[model samples]
Target: MTLDVALSHRFKDFALDVAFEAPAGVTVLFGRSGSGKTTVANALAGLLRPQSGRASINGTVLFDTAAGVWLPPHLRRVGYVFQEGRLFPHLTVRRNLLYGRWFARGAADGASFERVVRLLGLEHLLARRPGALSGGEKQRVALGRALLSRPQLLLMDEPLAALDEARKAEILPYLERIRDQTEVPILYVSHSVAEVARLATTVVALDRGRVVRAGPAAAVLSDPEAVPTLGVREAGAMLVGRVVRHHPDGLTEVALSAGPIFMPRLEVEPGVSLRIRIEAKDVIVARGRPEGLSALNILPAEVATVRRGAGGGVIVQFRAGQDLLLARVTRRSADALELIPGAACHLVMKSVAVAQADIGEVAQAD
Candidate 1:
């Protein structure tokens, strides 16, 4: 296994008993505010020792309480990025980045100084202090510093939660580059469904310190039962598609398993395969194919299941070829349209509604 984790910890009213295995790519710990996502991450990084359990990555044991084996944070060779940049205000950006080199273990820092600077687009700000850069830029510097240490695994805890929308947008692409280009695996933590859908190869869902679900991003995100827990508005399906063509009218054609889907123009070049997260609320269900609709996407699908919301709505699951899509509607609409399991229906989606933040690599959203 690329990563193995199984532990039990207790603190006041909360008890965390979670077990999961995440491969070499990005694995996310996703859930609500107090779900122990951060706790799991900290434990893995050796920042928080678990009462009893074992954690190993690529055959190296980081911790084993029963066996009395525990590696210190520095020896664990794990890099951490916190919610805030936490860069040294007194040090120049270049020096801040170089500081990480001191803790680098046996390996020649896997990434070079110039390469790290270029990867994060931090060359221009190299002479400045932490106080001089924007929130996004500061985070980028923090990330560069962490990367310079040449860690075997990376742990990021809500790195974008403190940024505004525009700042968040600015830092996303750099993260995507890190996810795609680097060999190091990432163990990220976040509560946002949109974040999980875009960045995670595998998702471990937690609730009040307990792991509720764990699987590939596409499978876990499309599950109707997992939607409510993730958040009704954030619940959705993730589809992996490639950019076939770009239209002059601000739209990009994505060839998916079901059919060609057209969405707002993306910044990626043709032939780039990207993951798009379609929110359940944004999807509409029609008993039959509708004509003259403003929505550009209308794919034929068969109803797979119908679920009731905690309030007063119905959540419908549709199978579009190999991909699954979801639509949220009122109970009255289901009855009026006679929507049932295995019923043929058309799923309509609007192009403009798809958030750019929800597209591209997993790290972009997380």
Candidate 2:
């Protein structure tokens, strides 16, 4: 359940040097474009060779320059889902998926075609061609094709980059299913903060081809110092909660460490756990529990750290119960409230501010 990576390569202008260990869940290579995120993915997939590096999955060495261990692409047994589907337009979906079997080096090790199709919800569209499918469907097919190959590790290079917001929304749940239901580890690349918030169990932050931050998703994302590189407004907190109940008036109540949180109704049953992403910009810091506020969520918290941003804003890290919450507030507002380390306050936000795409349901075990 461990994937280790260390790569160093010299390019014309950019150089890639990174080392990190990704656990069993989805590990994201997160950064802006041209930050060597894809280079790492490519190195892992055997598409590009690093001048010096070592990669291993579950103790199986994929490449190690010092050891002269260089397994070719086919021998790597890594599944790749590119930005485009890359499916054969001439072939039906079923045939395209079956094409992955041609590269199977061994018995596929119990990864059958039926199980993959069922997992990806590709049953109905199996008879169609790539040209007739939607962007989301095409990507799902691509994922299935990769899964059918029975990869030791899955490499996804911005698989959702080609999709619109709607399309991304449609396919995210399926990817979540893969992350929770499957045993194979995933190396996913993305620049979207929303996607990283929802999909990443481990995050490797890259900047100018350097590994700036690499750790659990909660620890890396909650640090205000890292927000400047990730984008100030995009900084946020990921909170775990369980569905309490669905009200008849169209609001869903989720019990968090802070307290009960009310949000726009989610179409899910009670007792379901979720990871809720609340943007730092969306949180309002209140000096005390105030009245007459229209915001639906008011959580009592203690300020832990306040880091000034590049602009007029400041990133306020606070503790709400056992969870850490981040708020982006103007310096003037922070001064007005005299916010500082260990200051007691309350965080506020409207229920509707939580977009559907920002919430990820935790898949239950079998």
Candidate 3:
């Protein structure tokens, strides 16, 4: 299903105007707080009506201001997952999950009760109540609850915002499984680049109250010009790799477009595929492979674009193998190297630069 949104809503202090189309995949509504992301989510959920334009899913009109069409929240059939796991405190896991299907009107969804239980690893917790579950388990239950509703689209408004790093780590793999296995497309809202890097197939970036950039996740996240919206320190490139082997030296090898990358050992078994982020600031560019360097990884790269940002700094985009890589250097460095589009260079990155938090399990949309 394609979610087409052209909405305009106004508060006393802020006005929102945006338009975008999200196809049958995970399309992330990404931006900072109060950047109209929640407004878009609310509009799609039928909780907020816009003053102009309309919204629809796969040609099914949910709201059209001019035509006086407005579907109530219940009638919209969109499942929403909030920051907190709003599971019923009084019910067991099985009962709480069944409550979700009670409102489902059509055929079973991409997320059925049995499938969700398996996908979320809730088999052992069926008899347990919410209070007995851990934070990560609760969020997974909440996600399952939303999915079991059989909605056409899922709205996750910073679903991991309330969880700490450890809880986030425990739950992210399940999200990856959901994105890859489910037929239902998700409309996820998040500000964390790590989450976006991990789960989003498409990224719809918002700034202030307007749509800034919207396109495939690979292209948008790798674009040098997107640094302003992505935040300078957070801007990075995403690379997909397959776990080839684990070495005895406490390093796991991943095969990517740029040969292989060796990093700290990963707990996942071999052959598991994953995506990782390389922050722009952590990369160094060299004209040739350096003689002696502490960084063990170096990939052949070609310049794609050079974006000069504030504070005399420059963001250089390069095509490293089939994937993209980014480096943040000063204008002086770029000038000295005579960097321009299509210029060949080498990308130097330390194995440790790829943080544990920066790596995410692959979620290939069907």
Candidate 4:
């Protein structure tokens, strides 16, 4: 699946004009609230008519104002998953999922009912109604329903926003299963950087309704220059490594471009390659090898770029082998520490600062 979008729409206080394309994987619409992530998604869903532009999936035009082509939402064969579960109040979970099957339109290659039910862990709640299911369960059912509809494209508008942290965690891996195991190209709208990092194959970043950046998720998220607005502190980097071993002290060691890093134990086994995300804000740069620091991971890095921001702050980019790291500090700190481009520094980071959202199996979609 491929998505090509060039859209322009006007509101009372803001005008949205943006264009980008996504391939056969999850393409994330990332920005703060009211930045038009949802607006673009709606336009793609055929729910909102753009003043003038073309939107298409794999050469089939979904909307074209100039050509007077507009496909109804149902005919487009796109599945929608909203923030809330939107499950039928009076129907059982099985019934709701079966409801999506009616839209197959002879394309019965629809995701298997039993396969989807197991993938989403919806077996236990099959007999329950939407009102009786937990937040996470309902969302799982929502996902199952969408998959059963045999959609060529899936649109998710902050599908995890209404849930709490624990609930969000619950559904994220199932989404990963959807992305990796299924071929549906998903257009996902989100404001959470962590969510995008873990789930997106391609990222389309928006700022005030304009596209600030659009590229591979790892490439765009790892750029040192994007830290401040991206909400990275001491700004670390993303590293691809494999689990080497687990120790009795509740630590897991993984090899990186620089060296091996140890963190709280993970469930993964040796030889299983993993992507780990480290925050720049969580890193402490040292002028020399410190003797007694409690930090476990230290790597030599050369300062790449130093840019100044408002409020007497500086953003420094670092290159540690293949990994890109970022650090933000007071202008005074940079001067006193003698930090500059090409200077050698030790990046000291604690592994515990990494959250589950920062890491996942690196997606292979282009």
- Per-candidate Cα lDDT values, in order, are 0.87, 0.90, 0.89, 0.84
lDDT (C-alpha) at residue 320 in model 3? 82
Q: How close is every model to the real structure, measured as TM-score?
A: 0.95, 0.97, 0.96, 0.94
Regarding lDDT, does 3 or 4 come out ahead? 3
Over 4 Å off, model 1: 361-366
Off by over 4 Å in 2: 108-110, 364-366
Tens digit of lDDT per residue, candidate 1, span 199-246?
788999998888788898898888888876688877789988878999
Stretches of model 3 off by over 4 angstroms after superposition: 106-108, 363-366
Question: Candidate 4, residues 1-366: lDDT per residue as tens digits?
Answer: 889999899989999999999987899998878888999989988889888889999999999888999999888988999999999999999999999887876895667899899888888888999999889888999999999999989999999999999999889889988988888889999988778867888889888889988887777777756665456442445667778999999999988887888888888777777767777677788878777978888888888888787778787778887777777778898998888899999888887878776767654432
- Candidate 2 C-alpha lDDT tens digits along 1-366: 899999999899999899999988999999989999999999988999899999998899989999999999988889999999999999999999999877775754736889889989999999999999999999999999998888889999999999999999999999998898788789999998889888899999999999999888877888887896687769998888899999998999999998998998999899999989999989998887989988889999999999996679889999999888899889999999999998999999899999999999886531
Residue 150, candidate 1: how far off, in angstroms?
A: 0.8
Q: 104-161, model 3: which lDDT tens digit per residue?
A: 9675545678989999999999999999999899999998988888888899999999
TM-score winner among the candidates? Answer: 2
Which model is ahead, 2 or 3, in terms of lDDT?
2
Query: Which portions of model 4 show Cα errors greater than 4 Å?
Result: 108-110, 232-236, 362-366
What lDDT is obtained when candidate 2 is compared to the true structure?
0.90
